[model samples]
Target chain A: MKRLNKTLYSVSLLAMALALSACSHDDDDNEISEVAPPQPVTYTYQIKVTNLTSGQPASPIAVALHNADMPLWTIGESASDGLALLAESGDNSEFLANTALLATASAEQPTLPGESMEVSVSIEDNAASTLTVAAMLGNTNDAFTGFTAMDLSQLEVGETSTRVSVAYDAGTEENTESAMSVPGPAGGGEGPSEGREAHDFVSMHPGIVSAEGGLSSSVLTSDHRFDNPVLRISVMRME
Target chain B: MLRFNSKGFRKTVLATALFASAGLAHSADLEVTVQNLTQGIYFTPILISAHSNDASLFELGETASVELQAMAEGGDISGLATATEALSANNIANPAEGLLGPAMSTTASVTTDEGNDVLSIVAMMLPTNDGFIGLDNWAIPEAPGTYTIYLNAYDAGTEANDEIRGSGAPGEAGLPVPPPLEDVVGNNGVGVTATVANDSVHIHPGNIGDDDATGGVSDVDNTVQRWLNPVAKVTVVVSE
Candidate 1:
């Protein structure tokens, strides 16, 4: 994780320079300059994510390359509508489209328990020093897990960074774990609900209370309860 | 030209070395601010210690020593303070004087003794039997800068988390409900369990709060008392 964070830091410094040029205002606006600015060195990163749960299968992962100015998620705040859509319905299209994401990629299929999937994403024509990876646990209501705006610039060529990500509540939906809201096979593939019953602020997941354990109203079983560090993610700079 | 340049470089190097040595000879005064980030949990009296590198308050996966048990179970720092005093450490006890509520914060400052180069802080979280927020032996960097650290909740491994209101003395079986926490916590809990599965210092498994505040599986308020791993934020500023 530390190595990846360092690589991201270096990448972000270069990205910052590019972002400044992209948004810089010149004193002379009389002539639109046709000269193209120097494009930042593009780097390709391959991220491999593994679902470490015993039974919970993860939805498709959302891998993005962006600058440090963008933070995909933060605790104690309300979830973005884009994030809400992804967490509740296991879709990444809206998340990628809504955020000014430099580049985005996703797994082709749902990653099952103890399963791993690798997706490669590249930033073109711009310097991007940070990377954010997000994915949802399809069994829960709105629990998504991933890193946010992590520095990727310090990574040298051919080096990799790894992190164990804990689950985070999106605060967009409650953990009803009912048959009508969950998209996992345990809930028979229910998609996003028209309305939510979860908390409104993003926070650390309090974990599931399955019916087998205590919460009598929960439709979840013992298989639904999970611990921390649910996902092991590795980001390797390929270029 | 080469001789003159070498002579000037040597003089500059000597001056730099002298300045660095003089800086190291001085002590540091630090301003510490601690915030309880959890919305539902309350922190008892806080104990911030600046001790030597030789001592540590707690270690993960280890059994709680008698002194650690007293602090974790009852929020008492007298034992740990005595231990640090034996080593001539700088200590700050009970900056908040009493329970610090959720989203509240407390600040304190301390001037470190020359050799007390490490800093650590601890506080017991109420509504739990033996859980405490701790910043174990962190190396205080000599550089003059501000540093922030997040603290995790730890289990003392001394008693079972029966989730009922009980005594705060070491080796006691249930959680202690102080006057400030009595109204906040619920009652008529059937008791979560009577088992201490992992008898070593470990990350707290989190509270098992129920929707029912008056009578349920747990005496803790489900909406108000449960927390994630990180419970406290510590910011330290090292002054020259």
Candidate 2:
């Protein structure tokens, strides 16, 4: 009886192998009939930015996915006109229209202090290995906080990466903190005036010297001052 | 028995060779760029070192070593460089050769020796009592790639931030005003503080410069000399 059981088991294994081969053969026939151009895959990313400041409000967050060939802004280099517009005016229209961007998205409204906003961007058929996110600190003169050319190539689907950002001076305009130069609620002044009047190169912001901090001409008060890591940004690959 | 001994010796030699090759594989060539991110603050000569993971330049919440104090207070990197060299560290001292001005960048190349898998950088910020930009024992990645790190200012805990013109010696009371900064920094100011409150390395409280260039409470200029955190940006490119 044991010998008979072993023979029967071997016979069943052979039959199963034959059945699997037959299924593969059917799949091959179907594949040949359906062979066509490959469909493009869409890669989508969800970006969430949280304002961690006490008083400073963030401009509408602008996010871009692109190759690593160019960064939105480089330290010690002059800010592009597009970046200057966004940093000084909180408008991202020109920035989003850059030719190098693979995909772009922006928050519909400014993110208030201690609040969070999420924006999604999608690209098809190409890999976006670099990501750039930026926003203006609405109360300052040409002060913006965000990161540029952050590597997103290693990010996998359903994976998230979080980072805190420091403030950068666009250097396109002086940090006058005067009511006429600041465009935020504190000053309600005109934004993005003509010319690169300051150092004309991007650098870390020296922070605000409010009226309380001895800038007698400053329209800002102590409440408008902030420190580093002003914005907490998180990016997740959704598809 | 003789044949067995010979075979054992051959195996030992092969293992030794493998270990030697592994050590060679761990070494890396690094091109490092240090950019003063501050709009106004200047960095003294920077010291970049590639050492073992066991060593560090400065530790937070701990008393700074004498070498660290000298570098932080006086922009003297010789002491720290000597200390690290004793540990077989590969060091590039004074990469900027002098004060690195605001928004300026300097690059240095170093080929790390065996076991030197971590990098440390330190530079004193001008117009501060004992504040320094520090990157403590950042592990160098084995894979070839570019890495960016932002360095924050630290208080060496060895002097008072008087914001006055004083000696740069250890246990000093004020900042070292170099010739270039003489015109920008203020003078004849009462010191900000007289005591070292922390007495241990910590994050800098930042400058409290009054706009009075000649007779404010502090000699530092609030608008021109004061800076926020992350005073420097370091870019490291790793190669074989």
TM for every model, in the order presented, reads 0.75, 0.83
**Per-residue accuracy of model 2 over A1-239 as CA lDDT, tens digit each:** 34456877887799799989997998977856656688898888899999999889999999998889799998889999999999999998898899878889999999999999999988887665688999999999899989998888667678899999989999898887889889999999998889998879999899999988877678999889998889999999998
Q: Whole-model Cα lDDT per candidate?
A: 0.79, 0.88
Off by over 4 Å in 1: A1-40, A189-199, B1-40, B59-70, B74-88, B91-111, B143-151, B167-173, B177-184, B194-212, B221-240
Q: Which docking band does candidate 2 fall into?
A: acceptable
How does model 1 fare in lDDT? 0.79
TM-score of chain A of each: 0.80, 0.85
DockQ of 1: 0.15
Write model 1 residue lDDT over B1-240, tens digit each, in one string.
764565466556646875343223224688888887665677888889988777888889999988889988888888988888888888888899898876577999998876677888888888898999999877776667899998999998888988888888998877888888778888888889899988899998888877677788888865446776667878999976
Worst 10 residues of 1 chain A by lDDT: A22-31
* Least well predicted 10-residue stretch by lDDT in candidate 1 chain B: B18-27
Candidate 2: deviation at residue B115, Å? 4.4
**Can you list each candidate's DockQ?**
0.15, 0.34
